[model samples]
Target chain A: MKHSHKKWVTLVFALSIVLMLGACKKKVAPPPPPPPPPPAAPTASLTANPSTIQKGQSTTLTWETQNATDVSIDGIGSVQPNGSQSVSPADSTTYHLVAKGAGGNQEATARVTVTQPPPPPPPQPTASEEDLFNQNVKDIYFDYDKYDVRADQQAALQADAAFLKQHPNTKVTIEGHCDERGSTEYNLALGDNRANAVKNALVQDGIAADSIKTISYGKEKPFCTEHNEQCWQQNRRAHFVYQK
Target chain B: MKRLLSVVISVFVFSVILCAQQDWIRTGTGLGVEKVRVAVPDFKLNNATPQNTALQKTFDDTLFYDLEHAGIFDMVSKSFMPTQVPGMPSDVNLAQWSSPPPSAAMLAFGNLGATGNNLAVQGWLYDLKNTANPQVLGKQYTDAATPEGARSIAHKFADEIIFRLGGGISGIAETKIVFVSSRSGHKEIWQMDYDGANQHQLTHLGSYALSPRISPDGSRVAFSGMTKNGWEILMYSQDLGRLVHFPHFGGTNLSPAWSPDGTHLAFSSSRTGDPEIYVTDSDGTGLKRLTSFAGPDVAPVWNPKTGGQIAWAERSQVTHLPQICIMGADGTNQQHVTDEGFAVSPSWSPNGQFLAFSWMRRFGPGEPGAQDIYVMDITTHTWAQLTHGEGRNDFPSWSPDSRHLVFQSSRSGQEEIWTMLADGTQQQQLTTSGSNYEPNWSWK
Candidate 1:
């Protein structure tokens, strides 16, 4: 009976030792460990102060990064992880910042809207009217003691008529002038003839008769006082004065 | 019976001789044949009172100036006269005046006396050459004891002597000259003595008043004035001392001249859009258009002698230069008196034989010529330049006697009224204070 009891005890002890060995192997071969937490991806943020500005003005760009080894801006070279920079852009732009780490690269973008300034005011209507008239109209010069419009002055008369036709609402005064050589009375009559001749021509050219008035200054008012041909030629003219 | 017959024949013959002598004097003086050499010495102070001394000086100065301006006498200078002055016919030595030094054919002497505010002057004119019957004229005048009174006496005495010696034409010492003066800050009508004394403003229109024409009766002045409408003929009555209502012809009306009979007025008007000559009655009725040319006709003057013709400046359409033209009073027989050059401002002489005008012989730019006064004979159409190239001379008007001309000249650097003999001698400036122009002598 003592030999049978010792065999049972040995079998139970061997079963227990086998169970402990299985447990130790299980501990040694645990599932391949998680891959080191993905290296903690780098976090980046970018911002711009006073992004909208005039063409000649400037703005500052600010950026920040976490867990990054190198930081770079789209237009700027690599810089510190957290920094600020001054930049002037001629047009609307996007500022892109890149943060690089072991795991991956992160990018941040900032939009700066650029707008143009307003234009200046314009000049008065009356002043611009006079300016336009002076620019377009031309004087008709005459020969000494002559009332007829010469051939060379035909172009000036035609141009004047064209302008007058374009501005149908405008009225004009045609002043006939003469050089200081003839008697006051004679020159007065001559000036009258010159002014009337111009008026008749203008009427024939389709300009309204009532829109034009004539005056004879004779030699009383001369454009130039010098006693030379150049000056006399300037004095003997049919000058046009624009009226509202 | 024979003795009675001889007496009657002698009387008739004597009367005929007297009439012949009077006819010779008129013919000789009428032709302005020769200037009568006259000697005028300082008037004697009959009573050596202070009043007499002052009055005598005024009388002497006025008398001398009047005779010098008469244009019919050659006055002997005071330096050439003998020291012995004649107070009356009894104190005169005719031979001394007719001698070599004076060479005077006539002598005028006067004496002045003042009693309280009353003054008296006794004057005598002697024919020095006819010493046997030396007394030719004798006159006595009494007036107030003031300078004006003394001047009046002198003027009367001078006119008497001038009438006796200077043909039948009346002396102009008492006549006035109407002109345009800017002294009152505007071109206004002004009147002065023929010798430029007593200058005064006639119109206060406060605007431009030019080319004054006094009436023949010396009662009104016609001028061109700028009104709200335009330039119009304005009449100023000397009797009323203010402007009178005159008709306003539409457009510009200028240069008015009255007829010799004081019945009509001639002027230039632009009523028809072209300046033309127009004549209207003195009462602004019977308006008549005299010219109808395309060019301008201006400065119309009437013939003072017969009032039968009108002269004006017409701008020729062909030449474009003003030419002197004349026409009958009824607008007939329109003829051009000036053929060439720029002729303007025509003035008819009193005798109706000549038309004086301003002519620019050479006109146009760069042509160096001057405006001068020229007298043209109407019958022959011949012209004589009265003023040489001495500045610009224009607007000549004949004196009443037709022996002198008053014109505007720029010889003194400023336009001033100047008087000269009709033959262009004895040029004298009459205005000096301010610029004066367009002088018109009174008809009387």
Candidate 2:
């Protein structure tokens, strides 16, 4: 019995010593684990949600960075390392983000495309009498600020005059338009002159004067939405509408 | 919703109060007249409600802006005013208002509130230098609690203050600027408050409407609209909200101008081969030819005060530059107001002493001249250029008080309506959206 007890005590003492040695080794450390691999250089990535949209629509931009101290996106200024934002682009645009850290700067890009909305459906032939009149009668163009009939527009006016003569029962209203320029009042007068010039041409062409009317729209009605000379020229014209 | 409304109301009122205490500098001391230095304190609230708070803010803002644009006063900034906004006669501390930083000579303070459906405001103007007789003027205005009523209340009070302090000339606070806007995808006549608020599209012709001239009585607008019949002078009644009939002469009629008494309209018509000025009753009868010029004659403006003369633009030949000309209301005594350059759109001053016209000096090919507004003394035939090389400025219309003019300019890239003092000072742009043109000040 005394020998058995001595063996058990010796085994217990050995096990405690071994455990203590293992703890001491851990406390002392084992070469510092190679300094954590020197902290990898900063890398940034950005992505746009629903990367395509109709024109004027908005999209969400999200970014994430690895080991970055600062992050910034092109055209968007500084932002958090991990965050998201909403952006609206009138056209296809590319967004870039940079992540800066002690090691170096890294960048990534995301793109969003904005497409134009589809054009409206074509008007039906039987939509209305006014639509029919507008579609059939070609409009005449005018010079800026001057109301007199241009030499080139006479053929279109002659065609309109002949149409008015054929459709004696249908009264016609000549609409005057001007490009967006000059004073509003002056444009009104100019538009009047243009419309009158057309009516006078029609009257001289053997169309009954009573079948025609004129109104001035002075720079108010624009066929083209662009601001360039091409658009302005298209806006300055005389359009015809038929009235029962 | 209630909390949001209250917060918005409070912030708006506070900001408006803060804005009134801005720089009190006056630029139009051209004639060596000392500007009236005045301080407008934030109106004290007599009673508090969410709706009233919002209305009070609008009223205070409108009043402050009106006073600032008077062109005769040096407005003291609110930052310099004393912390206490004394609203009434007995509550005011004269020394605080008359003190250093602002050194205001006059004080305009009032108490305003909206309760239920009604709004009331009491405004007082005080002469700070005169301690014994400190009160310069006092006015009370009441109306509905709506935004329009609040604005009207502010305008009436401001006008009263101006009448009492601005050398006997009336204020244009209650005026409306009738102009054309193309924002609706088409040209339409629009009306706005004198300070460019509450913009409303008056005509929805869907076609183009132009040259909207409000009658002296504010009952109708005589404009030219395109109809199937041709460019006939169409009249739009303000009260009827529809087109009214005008005698059609089977040709182009445009640029309708109203006489002072609202009895007759003078317009340019092409019924007689060339555009010529003509006069007719307001109902479109009793037509009489006013100008028999061989070339184009257009844009006739009546002298509302004189009632016996009209000014128009006349060209001796179609190719010649148009010149400003005046003739008797009876179509006699024709005289040219301008001798040189391409001048048009002549507007007569309310007092019948001056004619403001758009002129392009050195108007020819390769000349570096620009269109500018010029005011002429009818008696002396002497003129002074009010604008110089600031884009193309034209369509000079006079304020009812004769102290200011509204004109159209392309200086800001797009044609925008602008206002300036009679001596060409304090130029301010009034419209910023879309393109605005031909601003006509309403008759008081």
Candidate 3:
């Protein structure tokens, strides 16, 4: 009877060891609800198709993103979403995409290289208005609804200052701005703020304050959308004017 | 202002002579005088043009576009011409250049000043139709120390030629635009001449700032910005980066306007529930409320033409529909102008006879909430639509002369500033790139 009992204890102990081995095989908490599918990473992308853009040429950018209910572009000027974008990139142009899709967020990118507009078409006997107009246009942008000189605008501002410096005889008028989200009065003030922001910046960059003037149109102008920051973003900015 | 005027005159002269007339015009197209043809003398490289250089393209293109954009004269195509009009019409391309063919009438020429270093362009427009050799215009100037300035030189030259052609220089070639950017992730102002030359940034800080207004006096600016708390009216000195904010953080302050005297700041705020117009000292003192409304109101412009009359917009009933209103500086004689869909951003003309407001076309094809700019004759009470485009446009400010209104537009799917005649005629885009909105004309 003692021999039998000892045998039984050995058998129980062996069974316990087997169970411990199974437990140590893998660590995890009952597979944890499959982790709600990773918040879908807010599908985002920027594209510059016709990849090679000229210094002053327009290119089309197509951004396709899904899942995100909201989105915005970080440094590049105002852009609207779609399958195509007609962009004249003077500098490195990027299109920031923010979107939402069913599975989650997905992102994509398109690069654009403006390979210097074809040498003004060999100085045609007669020039095209687009060429001059493109050169005349100085693209700019602002933050949310504010019109202050953002740090990003420094390059363009300094370039403008340099132009003013060289021209010395040239005078430019600064126009302030605001997106379409605020009241007219508020936007006007914001526009003034934007214009003044530019004037202050230009003057500080060594352009004479007397040489630069300003104007404000509060939320009166919208470049892209009727409702989203995509469009409102364009509405907020400062512009300049130089006399003939 | 005097300095600006002198510069204008100089640039006008400098641009006319330097900017080359295109082949149609250089070759002579759009001459109105079908029989009138102009010759582009081969451009001589007073400074040699580098092969396949961006500057060369930029310089050559600058001259071509400036002349064509003027729309006053016709130009011949380069390919159509026997040889490239190398420099200016004065260069005399004895081989390919001719008169009386295609009814040529005038001659224009100029030179690219120097190479590697900044270039100076000089050109002249002559009416060949007149035996007197009518030397109509001439201009010369310096560009950026490098090839970059070639565009500016071209622009200046174009402006002069346009003036000579009697097209009235309002288009490219002479105008500078200022706006904001966040390439550095923070808001700051920037500016560039009429031609896209020399881009730079101003104000390098981590804080988010906004609303930059240039004073008619061209000495200072006013805007709404944050200083710790929320938003407030900040007056910035164009000469000194002096950000003077009102003593208190006004409720999300924005829409800053300068009184004709440049001593007062007319702005819009909601410190009292609904947004109301208010006036304050340029230094941020003497706060005075100017409007009372249950609904949102904003865009205050002190009329330089109307003798201190304050113009703005207010919502009398429903939030969606805003009515245009005007009152005195003291908030007297309150008057309502419209009972339409939605109206906001009231800008008074320098002459004060008109007020330009941003009007939204309630039902449109492209989108539901598309906006437009409108001009109201104070005496007639009739409204005129200034811009008609695919996308939305708002923020309309009239030129000092009141003949033109500058506004923001999203016609090309990008927000940009544009100018249109008060009659809504010549709608030209001011800002070509970037997202820019809210344009205010300067009395200066």
Candidate 4:
């Protein structure tokens, strides 16, 4: 038993030396881990969730993103960060969002969707002929200043596009929008340009000219509360509805 | 179940294809010019009394005059009605005239009535051919002490009518225009319509220019230019289109203004080795020192109502922001009124209660597009920002009536003209497409 104990002590001594030597070797050659990749700047991206908007009145194509360099919206709908586009699909419109850097580059494509809006409610018997327009229907909006479509709108926009493609008999109008950042006339023109741009895109996708129209409602309607950038984001967008 | 669901879906799809929408506007095919027609019937007495019949006619004519002056309508004579009227109709008969009076879609009409001391007017539009229900345009009652007095209420009615029509005013002969141009390449001076349509350059000589001014009476324009070299005070007469330069030996002389009485010009000069306020004659002589502080002071304007003071900017330090200071015309009781940031170009209201000035919050080499206009209540130390959002908006000049202001704004993707009310409402672009700058309003 004493002999066995002596052997155990010797083993312990050998194990301690092994551990010390191993630690010493690791300490001597410790190389830096390549300066930890500059804390990957707050991630910005565009995303669309449910991926769809209903038809009739203009619908808000919603989205989300993080670590955005800067966010801008184009083509009928406003944009949020992380590659999200607020699509107004009178029929079906696919909003192409290019998440860019300060130098204007495609950083990411978050939520790509073909939006289709559902048919509007039938006119009321008591409704004046102009009552449909009296809704003062303006463009749709997103969360304050955000152009990203959270997962909620993805499926909706795609279904909308497919439905519009199948129903080639219907015509649609795309309305561009902007928050109240600039002059009224200028904003209106900008909104028009955005809607026209989106309409042109839809034509590229085989939507006919006679079936699509464009308009701009510069900063006329907003869904958010307040005058800051957050609310402004919701105000800047393309809204889709029947041109009639 | 699958087959039944498919059939139901097919039916839904069929109806979706069946309900296509249509475009209904007449202009969708691009054929119509947006326009309105106005008709002034020979003034008829609506009431039994003829006491102010002549006055009523004048009043109705004035209302017609203001509407026509707005440039939104073609005034037509109802006496030339193409045919006998049927029943009264809503809206005006615009498209029926064979000669076609300007091809308008809307029309306005009115009637005048006179009672003992008062005159009442009622106006409506009638679709002469369809005369089923007429659209009433306006109605008003006023005192008819004089023919001209009777017309005053009509003018107000006309103004309201034009406003509701969404077309702006036009041919304001009483409203004078001011602008700046480098047409001769030296950034001299110019004036034109409030619309920036009829442009006329005011100065023609060698002057590196800035800060153009119009006197209280609109008879002349005063600006800072360098005729004799570095900088000098310059004045231009509306009648002769000639410039008279104010003189001083100094580092620089810029930002000229007229005394409330129009006899003297208050300006900034570095004559005492540093910029300070100076008062001189209209011909640029007899310079009297106004401020004692040894700082950069510039852009002086007299109080239109009180004539009790002049406002100018004073740089507190080399790195400190510029502040606006007001003092008596001779430079006593001087006190700092602005402390927010780099403020300049102080203009007083005709009522002497408020001052308008340009303030730059952030400083870069020259601050590319951040300058904005602000108004301050002298009695209440509070100020409000007028112009905002992208591009440089500065150099605010107030109208003689204190109703509106003309300012320089780089808003049209280029520097042009802008106008807004004194309370910072009804902001609109005044200049047509041009590279105009430095708007100075005239009291004429």
Instruction: Give one digit per residue, the lDDT tens place, for model 3 in A1-244.
Output: 9999999999999999999988887664457555555545555666666788668777776665555564444444334444555767677654555555454544455556556454555554553333443465464687754444677877777776666676676666666667765344545545665676676677777877767656565554455547676776666777665545
What residue pairs are clashing in model 1? none
Q: What's the TM-score of each model vs. the native?
A: 0.72, 0.67, 0.52, 0.43
- CAPRI tier for the interface of model 4: incorrect
Best by DockQ: 1
Give Cα-based local distance difference scores for all models: 0.82, 0.80, 0.60, 0.59
User: What local lDDT score does residue B249 receive in model 4, on the 0 to 100 scale?
Assistant: 50
Go through the candidates in order and give each one's DockQ. Answer: 0.14, 0.13, 0.09, 0.00
Q: Any runs in candidate 2 off by more than 4 Å, and if so which?
A: A1-184, A187-244, B1-29
Docking quality category of candidate 1 according to DockQ thresholds = incorrect
Chain A TM-score of model 3 comes to: 0.43
lDDT of 3 by residue, B37-61 (tens): 4554444566554532455567767
> Can you write out model 2's per-residue Cα lDDT over B178-252, one digit (the tens) per residue?
988888877688888777888888888876677778899998988876565556778888898888877786566
Cα lDDT tens digits for candidate 4, B1-444 = 323322332343344334422101110011232336655544446664455666766666666655554544567665665443322233234356424643334455555666666666655544433444434354555666566456566655665565455323222324567777666666668787553445777777654555677876787887766543345666677777786544555445667888777878887665444457788877777778888664456778898776779988776554444678889988898888876556777878765766888776554344442678877767654666677754667678776545456787776776677877654555777665456677877764
Ranking by lDDT: 1, 2, 3, 4
Better of 2 and 4 by TM-score: 2
Instruction: Tell me how far the alpha carbon of residue B308 in candidate 3 is from the true structure, in angstroms, after superposition.
Output: 4.4
How far residue B444's Cα lies from its native spot in candidate 2, in Å, is 1.1
- When sorted by TM-score, best at the front, the candidate numbers are 1, 2, 3, 4
